[model samples]
Target: MKYNEFLPITLEEMKARGWERADFIVITGDAYIDHPSFGAAVISRTLESAGYKVGIISQPNWRNVGDFKKLGKPKYGFLITAGNIDSMVNHYTVSKRRREKDYYSPGGKMGLRPDRASIVYCNMVKQAYKGVPIIIGGIEASLRRFAHYDYWSDKVRRSILFDSEADLLVFGMGEHQILEIAESLKNGLDIQYMHHIAGTCYKSDTKENLYHFIELPSYETIATDKIAYARAFKIQYEEQDAVRGKVLVQPHGNSYIVQNPPAMPLSEVELDRIYSLPYARKVHPIYEKDGGVPAIEEVKHSIISSRGCFGSCSFCALTFHQGRVIQSRSHTSILEEAEKIVKSEDFKGYIHDVGGPTANFRNIACEKQKKEGTCKNKQCLYPHPCRNLNVDHGEYLDLLRKLRKIKGVKKVFVRSGLRYDYIISDPKDTFLKELCEHHISGQLKVAPEHISPKVLDLMGKPRREVYDKFVDKYYKINQSLGKEQYLVPYLMSSHPGSDLKAAVEMAEYLRDIRYYPEQVQDFYPTPGTLSTCMFYTGLDPRNMKPVYVPKDRDEKAMQRALLQFKNPKNYELVKKALILAGRKDLIGFGPKALIKPLGKERQNIREVKYSNKKPATKNRNSSKNTKKR
Candidate 1:
């Protein structure tokens, strides 16, 4: 249970002199889970499986220096990654009116500042052990892989490599790249000489060498515009196109150099191999006895599934990272893990949600097609679902049924948002009904972003009517089963083409449904994302057409307030919106009410003052004559 137990060396009196020769460690700033499904966890496990020793430093209170010391001394090298966390981006509201609440950090106030945390962690590791190689991966380092504009800071940022002070920065998916780096170090190859690997970024030997870049996927191709980006990569709801390609590499002070296209996505067998690592449900005894990840009070467990998104919301980044393929583990693997959870002393009643992007769609399709070799198309956020892609509810239904049967399992739940369209699309309605009856604990969260067709088209979401039909059907099914559950629809505000009018219409739709959401997300422009470009450029990058974009703060606030009429202030806001939208007629006003006042009344005061002397004289004379009579 001591810090030095896992380390090959001791750092009792480290201030005097530093030691060399590490056992090669991969230290991550991500939370450690037994299952290596996530990027950071998987990479760490991958390195360990390849014969290199790895230790996870998950979700450390990075502000404290002692937290870093707890990992002990690294005998070889260190791999530093924040997993899927992005450092360069800050939470922002595109709404015209900014509130104090809007400034609060996302996931509540306690969330760590990602960029600051990464920098501090990297520095602390280096100070503790000199000459240790620190490599940065995950979204934090990937999208910020080059010099780019940061909307949050409103400034251009250098590559994360320079900012984090890590030796090498790997962009895109890190599976193959991280493994290569670890193997080379274990074989006694210099870390500096390993830059030739694709999907990695390192400082060049000379300045001239920086410009002579390797050809990878062009950011220009993807960055042409939002529509173009969406068209190229967006996933249609039913289509299964696994378009894996090379990492788009941009060296310092040079144009984008894309590496070889993505390797064949990890097959089911490879995926199963990675997920099946012997991960301790709780932290290792040594680290856990002291306060490590899954802290003293928190339960320690890892996520089990990855990939498969049926929602196909245009603004999401999951489809880009994990792809649209619905790949899941065998039911036996899930049950085996559940049993392990029950056996663990630290097992709390909570087995955090079991899902990838979309939880419900599991082992839903086969890889090969009947006639076609493999589907190459990628955008699933289309109007209609795909015919080739299978929609089978039987496998997932059986899996859910089995998971509930685990003896020690208090409550097995599905926390990930469900794709109602896909659920209804299933040939049998049994899965939907059963899911509503058992899985939900009163409230089931769904994302029906907007009710307006114009807005839905822009978002690539199902029609408003589709959501309405699902809502009615959901309630009916719940009633039939004698269960009480309400649908919580996730809505977005101020997306591209969501003008004040469209926002007003959406608000009206919400009011008609008699539902008020506690959370409403303002669209933020993440780099390399389609929506972000559309927001910044003001033109659809695909067609170069001017899109209706609302940039005013007050307008955004008005739109946001319209959806929540529960607030008394919003009543006034609705009136203002009606007037601003030039729908005063909708307020039952006539032409007279709408017209401006005439000039005679406006000029009367001045005219009366100027003509006062003559008028007063004539009146006084008439009054004097009347008094005398």
Candidate 2:
């Protein structure tokens, strides 16, 4: 049962296994940690289970071909990834400065991976292996499978398949796609014929015959015209569903990049089998001396109960990657994993988390989704909850109950965010009560993003009133249970449709609520999201309405400062912002004032207030008598 001794990482290890060549070579930008939480570990293990000899090349040097040749050459092909996060996102912060630490690297190191790792690694592999097929996946490849705006480059970039020159690109949850690709290669199918597979993108010549496919605006057109780019993005967004989606093609130079419909959501039985694979559940021993991989600690004891999301927030990439469908593991499968966690030496009777993308979601949005796929043009939990949305948390609550009852388990927390709007819409309040009583660890985090209706609509979030009702109900339930808990809202600044006036209004709302967040998220324009489209084109892709975006660094800083106005460091920025908005009335001393005046002005106000006050009692005895009375 202990099948996870880890796959071969060196020539000696491969020779020891009596293999001259591996069926697959997985090249990754992360240290080799054989935990299920890691994508490389799962894919390699899944292939091994399917009778393919797989090898790993983790954090290989891109300066030369020597590192790429360590695994020799795979017989089937090379699977390349930029680790768990997009290479650019991993390497930089929101401010576009290089990060000092990479959790995916050994010893929390930096610079182990190159920028745009999937493209770089694939090129390296191609140089070393000659004509052997190359396949790229993970966040970097998935989000870039089409023409998208690149924040780092400050312009639109072509599909990664074109840039990496890989034979095929796998996007989204790739387990099923990996299996199908392997089977086709095993049957001696040509890589060119593999274009029809779902969840894949490949390059084709113009002479190739095409049928029943939607042609997006040519890459050349989008690259030059912002409006054309937004229009292209809109077409891609509408056809992401598996059941109703169409084959989409976009021309690039002489060749066209064809993307098949998304892969079908894995059924419960399939998801259970995937999660039940032999994962070592920790960082591999090869990384021990270098202080081990830092990313393993967070997920070592947690369970990924489900995958995908239907609460399609505009800023989120889940729809583009995971698709707007929910697929979850069976309760028995989750409990089995929990039992394994309980037996671990490091587990001290606590399970860090027990959920996925959206914690409480256990099934698809509605019954129609099971047969028809998700609605192509409408969302389930955005704008407003759909009439047919089947909102029930009973099964999820039951699973949590079972987890808590397992032996040696003291507590289980739902650290993944709850979709507040979804919870508030359910007529039955049973799930809400159970969530408050059992799952919370004194504080629950939720994403309301912004309070402005304009911004909220742009975010594909429910109106502010929906979140308000949820908060009120949450406290009401907690009070009845005799527990004191708080809701920590995730707020964003400088998103599209958020102007200086809106930012000031947000600050005023924060003042009213008495909540000053320690951290605020600046709108990050990552690829393949509606918000990113607006950030790039200055027009909402869905409606083609013009939107205001705070692109200047100073303007963005002012917006962020208003969110944390109580911090002394943000004082000057907040003062300047108030003046800019022509709200000087908020600058002086008053019950509603956001900040105080400096030095002489403050002292003069104090003196005026003191002089206007009634005189103090002259006699100490009379004062004492009054106090006694």
Candidate 3:
């Protein structure tokens, strides 16, 4: 029952004792992946580094009163977060015909769990320990920072802070915000006065005092639609409305405020201070005691070399939270952490993966010199081969090589999918070839998203030709090395411009390449994202151009099926697609066709006694004339 009881004991023992308070506890519905790469691991480690004793309750199956009691009382309070489990948005369709077994979970359905994980966790914490302050963070709490559209229910849901009954919701990256909260609480600071934090949402007792309290700029105009959202937020999409960007809105309270991003990227000293913490690479006692681990098998004891992304995909939230500028740890610091993983007993041959938003892109910047410069353009996530940023792979390549040489390290793999266009874009192919030969485990994953020029343009992806060139070169290198490694290109369905024709073309491309993807992700419009805004508003917010949007669930489902031509159920979809493509002949003849031809003997019709048939009148008359002659 004691905090230092090294030997893990039952929850009953902890409950029996009246020890119902601790320094701090994290209430999360996400699986603890023990590695530093995940949200729970990083945040917990950061808090621990700041001298707070933290305990994690990862992915509790049932978030009830009993669950809270299991995690022995915290000394401080509770940090409630959903970690990386998407508790905010519903990613699955309700129709049974549309739902497919997740490739990741085998039989599991994709969507928000019925019993809200974050909400239940918060309620359980409050019920178990009275007067204890609870702080919530992560995607579930962050994206729901304001009143936004909920796709699952097809309605605007209230701010998560009010709905979850938590003290505060930390939006965006919580590295500094969480530390500030803990320090404030320890110093006897009340939750009511903690509204000054930039990336957080909290409720106030006084409604009249809200406007003067925080001066968030009006980002609502841009946030109102996806194009504007992408243009303003996408890291690589540099054309931002200089005066209009970085505005914050309290949708629930009907208030507006603005806070600038961290003036400069986190310094190495700051990063070291944060990433250097004693991380216990093990499952939380509560989860092990309960006999469950959601992503246990996939958990690779991971370490991050960098933070943020330069290739700002329009749909991604990383640029919004971490910024487009890449921040990295010293090579020494990264190696030191890698050594710890090598030393851990729990570590297998796999290090899970080592990379950030874009794995190969490390230690890059758009500016020639580090200075305070404002971006005014709207569409920052688009236009292939980002003109603003300098792409570098040397430092990353060196790190990868060094990691592989580390003693006790069996295999240092790059599980994160590479940005293929970026990799091939490098003038020197040595880095890429080495990456393919050393990092890959017979398969390298890449995201081409779509093959159509228009779709790719809309998605802010590199041209299809760029992907094609990379594929050709990648395969040639593989052949030379006599390696059977393959490039697994990920594709998306039902984007803003992706019509039935585009979907069919993509399917045909997949068939031509014989890339039968086992998994196909249907586009889910997450709140606060540009894609979601586009989904809601038909026009592109950037240029005010008319865009084709598919709202029909059935059309979306068919588009998804087109990606997975190998699935037997998709045979009809392939047939229909062929007809739609004006290639009906392909339906019965092509190799991609579901049905094959029978031999000549089977094609011939046989006459049976019971069969109804008409006599051959023309043949009989001709025979009679011949006989007379």
Candidate 4:
């Protein structure tokens, strides 16, 4: 098969492929982009590689069953996903306001998919064809496999398995899980009875067959009680590993949502096959008239060198979705992809990226993780690097060196989130030096998140000292190389444990650094993150200690304003925050003052400066929850 041979989307195409009906129809909430970066595309292509006829139904109109029926019923079932991102996150902003652009949609248009898209599509599929097996996967379903707190609804909702009509929910990467389920179905086994598959959740009536599992608080209890919710989240977070992870059963009213132990990470050769599939590497040509997918621009030239993160930031859902074990592609596979990219007509000499979930995590954190999986209790890098952590970036460094040597590739950038602490732990400066010389252009972006110890601890990030160490080392390396590269540190605001005082402390750090961020990542409490769990429950799931959560709208805005306190528009909010924190001393005309003394003349001057300019357009497509961070 060639790149031009896209999978069957329309029935005529299915007939052209000489198939009476598809064995499985993938219904996604995104415009069909047949690229490996897309989760839907990968799953569909993997099925096709296994000799299964897979059809795609991308972003069918929820109001009309006819749009879904267009693909017709499948022989096996329908594999549904809400695209690459969670539906609610794609639809709304941190403030619960509707976002104007959907990066995953055609031409960055919004409303291409409905909110709670997986459930909505399942309902529509049922209306279109009853009694057909419905299997739900993707970020939306994976993260919501348990009874999670829905940020959009501001209520604890039943597990997506219970709410949706999906017979099975593939919670992690579905390559293995989907194949197993498809084989079982092909052998005439019923979907309901196939609950033994790893990395999947199925609803069960009785607990008779559920053995060696831990039962969580019922959905009703966690919905009302915060403590119970925290407790449940703690248990769920701990048992996400493939090895030594037991079966987890959570009661949802009368039924139970049983999640088996996570599936094992694929080996290098197996992972290579996933990217080796004949992906068309473009948005389906049908959408060309609407302008190509805005999301593709960021990643079209990028290569995924690795998957999953052991960095284990509390605000990230990688733990729940991808697990902590890092799975990477072989260097040979990546080089092959680079050659193909170089051959493209649009090749710009620069390869956009050569990394993944965490760019530096090309291998396991330690040799122990290979067989035992990630430590259930200890983090690989947090307050400090684990004594057992094998912090070597040599393999990743070599991969980059090879890519940069590619004939047509001018530069290879590592544009993904990298753990500075990991770089700090490495004894050698070779990788850091090479990175400065070849990888970056003008500046490198890193997430310091906050400067407060208390907040950093809650976020599972290294202490401020570690970031300081990195900053010194980064600049020193650049200086030695005669390069003047800068660091664009990513910061977040209003996370749990970020009281007004802590927010003020972060402001003081910004003043010292002399960096004013244009965009501030205010903690968006999406489901399946420890930080989100803390936001909803006001208790740390790890310790059950009370965490001060800034829930008030005014306080949240004040915290955000404090980050960019240098902005003239934030004067009022900054003044209010400083006063509330009893740091009224900061509200004066001293050198340390965040804002100038409030006066009618000064205010008028500021207002004129602000109002004279055109309104700054927000890149609604550039969401803070982006995987890049």
Using Cα atoms with residue i matched to residue i, what is each candidate's TM-score against the true structure?
0.75, 0.95, 0.80, 0.95
Computed on alpha carbons, the lDDT of every model, listed in order, comes to 0.59, 0.90, 0.63, 0.91
User: Candidate 1 — what's its lDDT?
Assistant: 0.59
- Candidate 1 lDDT at 529 equals 54
lDDT of 2 by residue, 428-503 (tens): 8998898889888898999999999899899999887888899999999999999999999999999999988899
Candidate 4: segments with Cα more than 4 A from true spot:
1-4, 600-629
Candidate RMSDs in order: 9.6, 3.9, 6.8, 9.2
Models ranked on lDDT = 4, 2, 3, 1
Q: Tell me the TM-score of model 2.
A: 0.95
Q: lDDT of candidate 2 vs native?
A: 0.90
| TM-score-based ranking | 2, 4, 3, 1
Which segments of model 3 are wrong by more than 4 Å?
1-20, 31-34, 55-66, 69-76, 88-114, 124-131, 204-247, 251-265, 285-294, 346-352, 368-370, 373-381, 580-585, 588-629
Model with the higher lDDT, candidate 1 or 3: 3
The TM-score that candidate 4 achieves is 0.95
In model 3, state the lDDT of residue 167.
81
lDDT of 1 at 347: 72
